[model samples]
Target: MTTIVLGAGAVGTATAWYLRKSGHDVVLIERQPEAAMETSWGNGGIIHASEVEPWSQPGMPTKIIKWLGKENAPLLLRYRAIPHIMRWGIEFARNCTPERFRENAKSNLHLALHSLKSLQEIGAEAGIDYDRATRGVLKIYRSRDSLDSAQRSTDYLAQHGLLYERADPDRCVELEPALKDTKSTLAGALYFARDEVGDSNKFAQGLAAACAARGVQCRFGETIEKIETRSGRVQAVVTSKGRIVADTVVVALGSFTAPMLAKNGIRVPIYPVKGVSITFKRAAWNAAPTMPLIDDSKLFGFVPIGDRIRISGSAEITGYDMTPAPARVAAIIANASFTFPELKRYFDISKSKVWAGLRPVSPTGTPIIGETRIRGLWINAGHGHLGWTLSCGSGRVIADLIDGRDPGIPVPPPQGVVVARAA
Candidate 1:
């Protein structure tokens, strides 16, 4: 059977790669001239399985309300987006309970760990070198309360194969020498020994090339107009150029996944959450962390992607807008300056690249991946901020399903109108 995977971001590219690897004839389509030119192009580029907790955790509502309207706030809800997101917001609110929060975290962690393993396998198979690093992810906390809460979360995840070490201020500097300047300002840090980092854009591009070598049709510069359905099954994908008869379709369009399927009267609870990143050329090193670091107190992090430093963090409920707000970019820089005092000396604002991309977020913080009510149609979307982190595993599972084989790992049920496991 011929399978068509839509969009060429990391998620879609990974899906196509796995489909072809599993002995299926696949056609990869993208609106752009090439792959990874959208959200996957400008991410923080960290594959962080350590950061598996969802945003909709207990007591998060009050934090969101408190941070409203602040430009530098970690979570921003644009007033204009409130009405459009009312239904999703209600679901988000309902999932704030301790039970739901733990369940969602477990679901995300399962796939994230699987994705991490799958990523290494793909890299070995494809010989991809996206400036890979395995120094682990350091999440620093500024307050005792925050550190304690994260410790509790880590303890739960520890039972599920997450290896982490509690680092004091001195130990943190030993882990990442860049923090040597501000050791006194830190309460403590959680160093996740299992997490890794890399440039996601390069991963998508490299994997796409491998897919082409494997005889998967790479059709670029064609936009999807609609999915022609016949008797509750996908018939052909109508694109700008022409139609291709497809036996199956996997919708991996990221934030655009929901709207595209909605045109076919299928409602997936995927919505766009905007995030921004600023990449700077690393000057002959004054103080840049070699390891990936996320500040729990400040809600931002910077990682070394090759010789470049990329600082990214922020959750804005902006609807489908990919414009990089200058203030937001500046705020990211300012937030990093506090953590790394010498970062300003090396960061050249004029030479930096600022980018914004919409993350396809679901209310439960668990990606919706399964076979939908419509036969011959499948979904691998709603990965949220972990799109890069979840891509490889999601793709492998979906492809396994299409091949009528076991996925080897538990997958989250596809939310909304989805009625069956992908198998």
Candidate 2:
């Protein structure tokens, strides 16, 4: 059977690769001229299973309320987007209970750990290098309470084979000497030894190339008009070029997945949460931290890619607005600089790149992956901030389901994901 995969970002490209490997003819479609030109581009580049907790944790409601309208707040909810996101916001808050938060974190951690392994396997087999680094990720806390909370979370995740070590301020500095400047302010840090970092866009492009080499038809620069469905199954995908018939279709269009399926009366409950990242060219390679670092207090992180450093985080509840707000960008840089004090000296802002992409977030923080009520239609979106972290594993699961095999992973379907019974 021929499968048509929509969106050529990390998830879609990985899906196409796995589908072709599963002995199916696949066509990968992207509106951009190349792959990973959307959310997959300019990401934080950290793949840490230790940070798999959902954003809708127990105390998120209070935090959101506190951060409301704060320009430099880690998570900002735009008043203008309230009406548009009223339903999703309510559902998100509903999932903020302790029970739901733990469940969602476990679900996300399973996929994230699997994805890291999948990435390693793909890298070994395909010999694709995206400036991959194995120095692990260090998440620092500014408050003793936060550090203790993280230690508890790490202990819980440790049961699942994710290795983490609680480090004091001095140990953190020893782990990443660049953090020496922040020793006075830091309470402690958690280092996930198994986590990895790499350029997600480069990985997506490399996987797309591998898919093409494996005879997967990659049709880029084509806009998908609609997905025609009848009799409870996908029929054909109508693109700007023409209609292409397929036995199955996978929607991996990130934030656009929900709306696209809605036209066909399918609601996936995916919302577009905007995030910004700023990449600066480093003056000296040794001047920056070699390992990825996340500031737990500020909810931001700094990732080193070759001679550049990318500062990413800060969620804005704006509906589909990709505008790189100057203040938001500055906030990211400012927050990241708290950890790396010499950031301004080493960073060349003139040569920096600022980007904003809509993350397809779900109420539970877990991605909606697997077949829907529509027999031949599948979804692998709503990964939120962890899209790059979970792409390969999610793709593998989608392929396994389509091939009539167990995905061998715990993939609970999202609540209210079922569309009206297919006619």
Q: Write the per-residue lDDT of candidate 2 for residues 262-362, one digit (tens) a residue.
A: 98888888899889998877666566888799988888888888767888987898888899888998888787777777876776667889899998999
TM-score of 1: 0.98
Q: Against the true structure, whose TM-score is highest?
A: 1
lDDT of each: 0.89, 0.87
- C-alpha-based local distance difference test score of model 1: 0.89
For model 1, residues 100-133, the per-residue Cα lDDT tens digits are 9988888888899999999999999999989999
| Structural RMSD, model 2 | 2.1
TM-score of 2: 0.97
Q: Which candidate wins on lDDT?
A: 1
